[model samples]
Target: MSFADLGLSDELLQAVEAAGYTEPTPIQAQAIPPVLMMKDLIGIAQTGTGKTASFVLPMIDILAHGRRRALMPRSLILEPTRELAAQVAENFEKYGKNHDLKMALLIGGVQMGDQIKALSEGVDVLIATPGRLMDLFERGKILLTGCELLVIDEADRMLDMGFIPDIESICAKLPTNRQTMLFSATMPPPIKKLSDKFLSNPKYIEVARPATTNINIVQYKVPVTARKKREMLRHLLRTDNVSTAIVFCNRKTTVRELAKSLKQHGFGAGEIHGDMDQSSRIGELDRFKAGEINILCASDVAARGLDVKGVSHVFNFDTPWHPDDYVHRVGRTGRGGARGRAFTFVTPEDAEAVQNVEKLTGGEIPLFEFSGEQPAEAAEAVEEKPKAQRPRRARKDEGAERAEAAPRQEAKEARSEEPRKERRPRRSQPEPVDDGWNGPVPEFLHVSALV
Candidate 1:
């Protein structure tokens, strides 16, 4: 069904049309209706299924009629990361343009003066990370008592980041009678408990199974040695006809190194991770979205709730440590019903981690062979690569030593062929045998000298 069938207002529909989204995604079609009715909702859908818009669209309309108060927001959205929070705020600006609504983004890694000033003037929507929100609340810069609507986006990620306690505290401060909605790709027990404690008779919507990867994405696990991961990645990026992609690394250091490697190889690549400040992270994302960079090397910070359009590929430079992250990392591609490809480089040591990912997704990932490399005789032996040879410097050093030893060996052989002599000569020597002197004895040893 079209978005019109979902009961959105005309002005919002016009804005959506201008944004070039004519049809609503499955989650959007299902969840928007309940959200418009002001019901507590538990939306379970995989990443990149239009879940952000599902709530953002309806909330704009629901909040349009409400009056905002100073130091108190009419609606609140809690995101797990600064990137996700900023993304939601962008959505509001895009979809809420026709309507007169004010939104403020609250996140760490930046000055809070502007945020405090915005709160003072009052805001219709407050998109914040839990930490920054709690900080402001303690400082008395913002109040939750006036919040009429609440949304916990990516609740599982919040759990992973240890934000559940902060969320509980935030909920305690908000009015209990307000509308509450929780959205996630998976429904873990903690998220369920949070929903039960907070939401009242929430409508449950599941577009797909928990921890399931998107069907539109073609997935494969590449068996490569740890040292050759960069080689394999470069080979794929050149041969696969990638338009835009995000390469996910497990560590911030890896993200930095990989992006630098890609740039050195003449690829338009940028890096983002938790270590970067908010402005730098946003700048990188903006560059990626503006097509200035085709590849984004990122940590798990960008894995969840980041919406970049037309990403044709995702390369997992390192297998995700958390199985659930595998879903979101690949979810960056195949967004909005577009076909995409994802490849995960699995080293021998990553067997357990890859297995956990497969177990969570309920199926084994197919093995991918390099374009020109010969397939192994046995698939199970894919990880058993030949040992790497010694480095060039070590080999060169050994060659130099061998060349230097050749002259010494020849000199020693020449000396061995010659007659051997005593290391030192005696001070005086008697000539041949028993008193028969073949050579003169020393004068000092004579008996006449003694007399």
Candidate 2:
């Protein structure tokens, strides 16, 4: 269905059309209607299923007529990461452009003064991370009692980041009669418990199974040694039809190293992980979206909320420990019904990890048989190469040199094998001494000499 059929206002529809979205995604088609009705909702959908627009589109209309108050926003959107919060803000700007709505973003690694100013002047919507939101609330810089709408996005990520307690506290401060919505990629036990405790008779909408891999993504696992993972990745990037891709690594160090390696190998690559500050992360992402870089090496931090469309491939440099993470890592690709590919490098030690991922996805990923000689066998074959023959006189001269040098080598070895004893130094003869004052020697000196 189109955004217009989703009960969104003409202004929002115009904005959405301008943003190049003609039809609503499944999640958006299902959730936006309930959201526009001001019902409490529990939205369960996988990543990259247009979940942001599911709420953002309706929110712009719901908040269009709300009155703003100083220090109290009309609506609140809680994201678990700075990037997600910023992304939601971008969506609001994109979809709410036809309407005039004041929006503020509160996340860490930025100046709080501007956020405070935004809050003081009163904003129609506030997009924030839980930590920064709680900090601002405790400092009495913002009030939530007047908030009429609340959206807790990526609830599972909130659980992962240990923000449930903060979420509960924030909920307690908000008006109980307000509309609330909780969206998550997976409905784990903790998030379910939080939803039950917080949401009041929420409408449950799930477009897909929890932790399920996207069917559009063709998944494969390449059996490779850890030392040859880079080689496999390079081979795939060179041979496969990769227009843009994200390479997932479990550790930030690996993300940095792999990105550097790819750049050195002449691929347009960039790196993003938790270790980078907010500005650097945003800059790298901007470059990626602008086509400055075709490959992004990232940790699991980029797995969940990042929404980049038309990604041709996803390469997992390391198998994710958490099975659910496998879903999100591949979810970065195959977005918006586009065909995509996912290649995971599986080492001998990662057998269990791959098994867990397969169990979660509910199917086995076909192994990608490397077409050429394996890395180990190729190296060994090169090392075992035969050498060319030398002249007979050269061989004879070599043998003669060794024969002549053998005795000296044996003598040196024998000397080194023997233990040496400590020797006493020889004493030197004493020299006769002459006194410079021979003519007038002191009486004390004469007595001393005689004694």
Candidate 2 has an lDDT of: 0.88
Residue 179 shift from truth in candidate 2, angstroms: 0.6
Residue by residue across 1-451, what tens digits does model 1's lDDT show? 8999999999999999999999999999999999999999999999999999999999999998978899989999999999899889999999999999999999999999999999999999999999999999999898899899999999999999999999999999999799999999999999999999999999999999999999999999988777778877888888889999999999999999999999999999999999999889989999999999999999999998579889999999999999999999999999988999999988889999999999999999998755565434323347465789977753468788999999999999999999877677534543334576668756665333223
lDDT of 2 by residue, 1-451 (tens): 6677778888887888888889888898889888888899999998889999889888999989868999999999999888888889999989888998999999999999999999999999999999999999999999999999999999988887789999999999999899999999999998999889888899999999888888899999877777778887887898788999999999999999999999899999999999999899999999999999999999998888578878999999999988888898999999888989999888778989988888877889997655665556324322444788776753467788899999999999999989988687755534435856457544454333322
Scored by lDDT, model 1 comes in at: 0.91
Separate clash counts for every candidate? 0, 0
Which stretches of model 1 miss by more than 4 angstroms? 373-451
Q: For model 1, which pairs clash? A: none
Go through the candidates in order and give each one's C-alpha lDDT. Answer: 0.91, 0.88
| RMSD each, Å | 12.3, 8.6
